[model samples]
Each structure stands twice: as structure tokens, then as C-alpha cells.
Target chain A: MQPNKITGIGLLTAAGVGCEENYCNFTARNSGICKVTRFELPTAKVKTDFAGLIKSLPNEALPPELLQMLNSDDLAQDYVKAAVYVTAEAIKDAGAAEKISSDPRRTGLIVASSLGNFLNVSELVKDYFMKELYKITSLIHGMNSYLPSRLGSMFGVAGPCYFVSSSCTSALNAILQADTLIKSGIVDRMLVCAVDVCLETGTFHLWNKIRVLSHRNESPQTACRPYCKTRDGIVVSEAAGCFVIERADAVGARGHATIRGIGMANGASDFLKPSPELLEAAIREALALAQTPSDKIDFIAGSASGSPHCDHMESEAICRIFGARAREIPLFPYKSFLGSTFGTQALSEGAFAIKTMNDNLVPEPLNIFERDERVAANAYYKAADYSSYHINNTLFVNYGFAGNHMAVVLEKC
Target chain B: MSKPKITREELIEKIVAAIKKVSGISIAPEKYGDNLFALGLDSIKAIQVVNMLEDELDLMIDDAHLPKFTSINAIAAHFDSLNK
Candidate 1:
């Protein structure tokens, strides 16, 4: 069966609060990663303090009632509120708020998370163990645990409301699920949201154990170098992204952005290791579903997260998929600007690609002085020049910890 | 000269407010016993209502009891029994 198309997309990230701001930042090739100012962390491990943190959620941003409910010490509920806020904005952008609001049964919601309320969990556990206080209320637990449902309730959407947790591939998985639900005639419209917040003390230790985190305290901006030979490690960031998707017929009637195609695959490799085969399959499948030939793909939003092995594997996958043509395709590493926030990266970059297609430009990969020579030799890879070209089609790739790989293709409407 | 105890009618009102507060649902008291799942109350929303009950009424309901608290009347009765 044919899939449902995404008619509208909205995003809130460390770059800026809304699509317009993010688009401008992208066009200007600006990076939102800077010093981590919201929370306190150890001075040593925070060497590269850069993170794409959303800094401007005004108190009056959400409905008064919703804001009150969120401020009630319910961190999980705050995530729901964050998802709802962005989802509502996307729906509004799609011009479907009235239609869905009047008949919510016709709408569905899918939220994805790599670590659901991990920050809140860490704090609660710490308080329990350290202070010997069981003051963590059930409300907090329920909100943290039921973010998807809370978001559904807020929007009055009675359709499928569940969380997709696949480490980093959660966003793409959520989008794929929304597409399937719409195709099955289960719902006419769906809201896809991806969110993850930064870790607290325990999370810091967990990353320290993984040894993928940068410990360079001097310069944070220079810390996360995705394709650079001098790259050390990746920095974990926090963000949330949402999109409003509808059937092609529905979107056509309303004249909204069109979702050309989406594809997903599993690595079937070890949870921590990379898989070239799965990545290639995912890209090939996404291109096939999009009905886009590899040559037509103008740019690629690389998921090169500065992990040396992952970067090499991803580069190899691209070479395998596009063959000789891969070297000519310009590449944009979004995570360089927005620190890798597992599930949010794919959707966030997807949103960025849509904006790039809309603006007729592609943002350059920042901080990479030299291209991956092998990739550059085989693929049409370059720091993109937005002024000289108009990007019609683009591919966005995302890889998760459990060998889950997803690639999505979007075209200009 | 007050009434000996609270009536079912009074209990239903409180239950309705709590449900609305927790699950963001608006329903008439008479429709409380209706299948919440059929009414679009999924598992996550069920947990939200249970948490609200614990907060508002100081009652602890097991996660297992969620399937049984499908309606306003049912949750109210359960809370009433617990208060006893």
C-alpha cells in the first residue's frame, strides 16, 4: 500500500525555538552548541561544554492551565508539555488544528524517546538513596512514565498513543509508525514527536564509562569534530522535535509540505557496534521508496557523530550505496551544530533538511577542515555552497546504539 | 445536624474533577462506568488518573487495579471503600 505523506513539519531545538529561527541559523551555518549553562556538571569531563540547549521557553508560552500542570514538579509531564507545544505548532503550521481539534478521534500521536525521563529518574533515585526520602510522588512517576499518553490526552487525540524507544533511532521509528498508521486507515493525521533531556550525575558516569564523551575542557566548540581527523569524541545534548503528518490526499487538499518517502532498517549487529550492511540497506530502501535515484539526491545529512568507528562505518555505507556518485553528493553533518541527542537528531535534521529544501540551500558542515578523503574521492562531497545551487532532494541518515539504522528522503514541493 | 456521611452523588462530582484534572477528559457522571478504553483512555492515561487519586484523596491504588477503574463511578466507589 502507498504511504501517508508528511504535510507539515515543526521543530524546537538548541539552534532556535521555532522553524524560522532554525532555518536562519542553518542558512548562516551557525552552531547552537556552546557552554552548558542550564545544569551543573563536573569541570573536567565538561571540557567541551557545548550543547544545543533550548534556552527560551517563556513562562507564558503554553496555555496557563497546561503550564500550571507542568510546573507541579512533574518532570515527565514537562516532556509531554514540550511535545504538545511543538506538536500543536506543527499542526497549526499544517493548518489542521481546527480539523483535528473538532474531531480528535481522526488524529493520532506517536512520541519517541531514547531515555524516557532519565534525568528525572536519576534525581529521584539519588534523593531516595541519599536523603532516605521517598518524597518522589506518584504524579511525577506517572508523568515521566506516560509521556506519550499525557501528550495524547492534552491534544484530545484518542488514536494510537505510544512511545517508541530504540536508543537513537526513536524519531525515525516514530515517523515510520505514523506513516504506517495513516496508511492502514487507522487515522487520517498523526503527530510525531521525539524528545530527550540531558543526564544528571548517574548519566554522566554512564557516558564516562562508554568513553565516547570528550574530556577536553579548554574548547567545547572544537570538541565534537564529526569527520575531522583530529576529532576526539561526541557530546550529549538535549532537544525535542515534532512534525504533523497527513495523507497525501489530505495534505494536497490543504496544500501543505509533502513527505516524499521514508525507510528504516536494523543493523542486527551488536548493540554498541556499527554495521555497514544495515546502513547501506536502509539508504537503498529509502531511496527506492522515495522513487529517487541515488544520482538525484543533491545532499546528504550525515549522522557522523565524531565517533571514529561510527564515522568510518557510515562513510563506508554511503560509498557502498551510491558507489562512484557518493563522492559528489555534498554532505552536511548536523550533529556538529546540535550535539547528538540520540532520538532527536534524526527528526531535528529531517526538519532542517525540509527547511533547506524550502530555502533552496544546504548548510555546510562546520569545523571539518579536511573531508574524509575516501568519501570525498568516491562521493560528491563538499562543504555546501547554498548560493550556487538549489537543493531539490536530500537524504537524512540516523543510527542508533542497538544497530537500528534509518534513512529518509525528502523532496521539494 | 449534618448528614451522616457523603452520598454517591457528591463522590461522583469529586471523582469527575479528579479525572478531568488528571486525564484531561470531560465526561458526564452517568457515563463514568463506560469502558475507558472504548472511550479512548489508554494505559498511560489510566496511570495518570490513578496518580491523581493518590494525590487528591491520599489513596494508593495498585497498577493492577487500573483495568478495574474504567469509569468515574468505579474509581469513586473504590476510593470510598479505601477511605473506609
Candidate 2:
């Protein structure tokens, strides 16, 4: 059950830049949702009004050399910038920057983004189709594959590098792959980074057309009511989380997180429609991998981000796994504070879980005015239940589009 | 193909404009001597600058030659050798 340890973590969310800022924001419990100001929303067309869109990390937050390279890549997509920022932060946080800087063979890179350079796709389409002689290369820069390869090239990590796209579960999948590589002795260290700059005109409208995004336009902050009776649907966001992971036996890391168990599955569930059976199966597999039972899980974390079906299915799955004991475990759907960041949700949630588990602070549920009737019966969490609580063994479950389900177990070492 | 960008000044204009277009940064005509990276130039923007220059001027700027062309002055120098 022992796996590679997560030495360093760098998170960039609407909560703010850096791990501490994100944790403070999560613990302080403030909503990062706002009406589209970074890019105007299609008020005339889509009902979805607001999203947590962050265009760039603060200049100070980005590594100086990486920032310069980004500014130089006039065509550098947001995904690339995010990947670079978090990768640098993680290496620095892990104190592995100097160690790995000398030996490219010791390290590898993995970057995941659900919708890679989606916003830039609009510009690319215009360049290719509209213009008589378009800049063809513009389209090439936005593709997903460039993300990790670029980071590897930048950091001189020659071990293994590529992209993983599994919709919302991408971050988990990235970490899962990193864990596999390390355990297999293929690489001693890995930079696992995931980003989704969700505010692209091309991609957002697609979600809007599908009507999965929230239309609580007037009240953007209270819009995404996950697991609440008044829940509507997901309020999209832009964010990224990066980690420096190494074999537990390899490095004396700063904050260590061993991958006790990880499981993922997919079935005949339709695209956009989550499969609860598959989710539960994934959780069971993860628990089995960790060699731990359900009763040992101190708390659970997931984003019941007002996707009624997903919330309902997740509730059923949790009840099935924990039974009446579910009432004793606190289900923290912290995305109620930050809008649902598509691919990086679980990673950001994992960051929160690490902070919560270490600090033993169970942050209050944000804006859960009234728990859903089904959630009330099966799970234990309410607005009134907000206060500091204990955390140890934690379970994180995430589902991507197209029935892609993932569950991971993290234990305090 | 696109009139073979005739002069270094002309090439610099295109490169500077490319920089502005790609990164949303505006460069002062006088700041050509300044390092573009120091002024917020990144790898993506560098590729864009190369792409724009290559396409418009019908000039082939090697990726290896990119680091040498760190500023407007440095890029103009590259264009100078290519032109000659």
C-alpha cells in the first residue's frame, strides 16, 4: 500500500496563488465566483452567467525564468504558463530544483489539462478559416501535447513526459500515472501538473449549450449550490495544481503524501452523465488497494457542485460504501467556496484535504443553506455543522466527463 | 512571399508587433535595445515572434537561433545576417 510520496505542492486557483493562499481561502470559506469580468459572458445566448476565471498567476508567483520564457512565447497558451508556474513552485517547494537541475535522468514530467488552450482555439479557428493565408502554426501551439513536453524541455527532465486528458479526473490520473512510474522504478521523481483555463469562448459556450453551467447570473457567489436543495449545476472555473512527487525512499521531502490507494473505472454511462456504480466500484478498488476498510476513513471530500445527478449518484455511492456510518463522516464539498474547476478540481480538493488532514481543521461548508433531502438522509454535513473537526485518513472521489471515475485514499504519515 | 520584409527596421516592426499581438505587451520603439524576456517575453511569445517573422518575411529563423534573438536589437541582428 505504500507508494511514492508527494514532496511539494503548488496550487493556483481562484482562491489565490500558492498553497498557503489556497488553503487559507479554503479554510476561511469565501466564494471566488464572480460574473465574467476577465472575459464577457454570452448574456444574449447562454444562461450560464459567471465563472471563476483566472487568466494568469501573479508575476511574482511565477518562476522568474519561466515567466520570462512565457512572455517571450507571444503565442504561449495559458495552459503552458500554468503548467510552468506550478512545476517551478512544486520543485522549489520540494527543494528538488537544485537536485534535479543537474540530472535530467532522475526526473520526469506529466501535465494534464481537460481543455487545453480552449480559449486560444477561437483565435486559431479564425486564423485558419477566416483569413485567406492564416498562421497555421498558431493552431499547433494550442494543442494539449505541448504542455508536458514543454515543461520537460524547460526543466531538462528526459525520463518520461506526456499529457493525460480524462475530463475532470485528469489531475488524479496524472498523479496516478506518476505514482505508477515511480513505483515501477522508471523514474525517481516526477512533476505532475494539471490545469484547466475554463473560460474560453469556444469551450464555455459548449457547456452553456449543454446547459450544465449555472445561470444564477444575478447572484454569482451563491450560484453553485452543491449538495444543497436549491442546487442548480456546475459553475465553471479556471485553475491549476502542481506537485513534485518522488519515491518515498528517494528524497527527504518537505510535506510527504504517500499514495495509499488509487482506483479508476469507466462503464457504459453516457457522456456528461456520471455513473454511480462505477464511482462506487472505483472507491472500493481504492480502499482494497490501501488495504484499509471504510471505517478507517476519518473524513471524505468531493465537490457536489450542484450537478444534481452527480450529487445524487455520489450520495448514493457514499451511503453504499459507508452505510449508516456515513452520518458520522463529514462530507466536505469545498467547491461551494470556489466554482467547479473542471480538470483540477480533485487536485485542488486533494490539496485542501492535505491541509485539512494535517491541521485537523474541518472547514465550515460554504453556502450550504439547506442540505438536499437525500444528502441529509445519507450523509452528515450541514451549514450549522461548520467548525474545526478532526481529519486523518481521507478519501477523495472525482468523476470526469464520459463516465470516467477516480477515487484516491490518502493517509497521514 | 510576403514581400520579403525589406529592412531591419521593417523586420523589427513586424517582430515588435508580433510581440504585442501574441503577449498583449506593447514595446516602445526606443526600447529595442532592452531584453524582451526581461520585458515579459516568454517561450510562447518567442515562438510567435519567430512564426510571424518567418511567415511575413519569408525568412527562416531557426529555433536554436531564438535565444540569441532575445531583444528587438538581437532579432534585428539575426534579420541583418539573414538579409545579407
Candidate 2 segments whose C-alpha is farther than 4 A from its true place: A58-61, A74-76, A252-254, A376-389, B1-84
Best by TM-score: 2
* Every candidate's lDDT: 0.71, 0.75
User: What proportion of the real contacts between chains A and B does each prediction keep?
Assistant: 0.00, 0.00
In the order shown, the candidates' DockQ scores are 0.01, 0.01
The best candidate by lDDT is: 2
Give each candidate's interface RMSD in Å.
15.8, 18.2
* Per-residue lDDT of model 2, residues A194-282, tens digit only: 88885766566666655466667888878878788776677888888888888877664445566788998886425667788899999
Distance from true location, Cα of A101 in model 2, Å: 2.0
Query: What's the alpha carbon RMSD for model 2?
Result: 18.9
